[model samples]
Target: MLVLVGLLFPLLGCGGPKEIIVKGKVTYDGQPVDNGQIIFIPKGEGKVSAGPITNGEFNFAAPPGEMEVKITATKELAKAAKDGLPNYVSYIPKKYNDETSLTATVEDKAENTINFDLEK
Candidate 1:
C-alpha cells in the first residue's frame, strides 16, 4: 500500500495546474503608468487580464509553454482623448491595439517579464 501511495503522489502532482509567473511594468514619458490594463493572450487560448496598474506593476500566471501576450492601456484614456480632454495618458498605437493580434511564446519553466512604454 505504501508503494502504491508513493506512486500516486507523483501522479497527483503532475495533474495540478502548471504555474508560470509573468510579470511586467508599464511606463509613459519616463514615468510609471499609474492606471491601465495589461492583457496576456496565450497562443490559441483565451486572454488573461491584469490590472489598473498598482504602483506601475502587474503580475499574472499561466501554464507553462509557448503563449502569446499583448499589453494595452485602459479605454478610459482613449475615451478621454475622444472627449477632447488634455491629460497625461498613453494611447495604443494603430498597431498592437488588438489583443488577438499580439502573440508571445513562453518556454518550459520560464518567468517572463516584459515592459511597455507608451507613446504620447
Candidate 2:
C-alpha cells in the first residue's frame, strides 16, 4: 500500500538524525581570540564539524555526541610564504590544538553554549 511504500523509502521525507547548533567563545591567557578556527571532532562514529572563530566567538552545526575540541589562532609573520601570501604561525599552545585536552558535549537540544578559557 502507499503507507508501506512511504515507510520503506527513507528518502521520501523520512525523519533522520539532526545536527545540533553549537555556539561558544574562546579565550587565551585572559584575552579574546581575534581570529581562528574551531573543530568539533566527534568522539564516536560521527561527522567532523568545524567553524570559524572571530572575536572569541564561534557557532557551527554538529551531530549530537561527545566531542573533542581543537582551537587554533595564528599570527602573521613579517615575511611572506613561497606562494607570496602572508605567512603565519600558530600561537595557541599545542595542548589546545594538535594535542588538545579540551572536550565538550553536544546534546540533542535546540542549541548549546560552551566556552573555553585556555592557558599557556
Candidate 3:
C-alpha cells in the first residue's frame, strides 16, 4: 500500500497547474505596431492576461495552455470627427481583433515569445 501511495502522489502532483510567461511582438504590413494592446484569452477555463503594446513589443504572464490571441492597434487621425470626438483608426483587420484566428500554445517555461504578422 505504501508503494502504491508513493506512485499516486507523483501523478497527483503532475496534474497540478503550471505557471507560464507569455511575451510577443506584433507587426502590421511589415511595420511595427505601436500604441495598442494584446490580450490572451484562455481556450477553456483559465484567467485572461492583457498587456500594452509599446514599440511593437508586449510581455505578460499567463497560465500554460491554449490561448486565443487578440491584437488591437489604433492611431489617432489627423483631424477630429464632426462631433468633436477623437478620431482613431485601427491598423489591424477585423479578423485579427474582433474575430481573431490567432492561437498560441503556452507552456511552463521561463519565457515564451510569439510574433504576429497581420494583414489588412
Clashes of each: 2, 0, 0
Q: Following a full C-alpha superposition, what root-mean-square deviation does model 2 have from the true structure?
A: 2.3
What is candidate 3's lDDT per residue for 1-120, written digit by digit as tens? Answer: 999998898787684456677778888988889999998899999988889999998887888889998889899899998999999988788798799999999876888998988877
Residues 1-120, candidate 1, lDDT per residue (tens digit)?
A: 999998888787675556577677777667786666666555565445444555678877765555555555643433445558854543655445563355555445668776766555
Candidate 2, residues 30-88, lDDT tens digits: the string is: 99999999999999788999999999999999889999999999888999999999999
- Per-residue lDDT for 10 in model 3? 73
**What's the residue-level lDDT of 33 in candidate 1?**
64
Which runs in model 3 stand beyond 4 Å of their true positions?
A: 1-18, 83-85
For candidate 2, the TM-score is 0.85
Candidate 3: C-alpha lDDT: 0.87
Q: After superposition on all CA atoms, how large is the RMSD of candidate 1?
A: 5.3
Task: Tally clashes: model 3.
Answer: 0
**In model 1, where do residues sit more than 4 Å from their true spots?**
1-11, 45-52, 75-90, 99-101
User: TM-score for every candidate vs. truth?
Assistant: 0.57, 0.85, 0.79
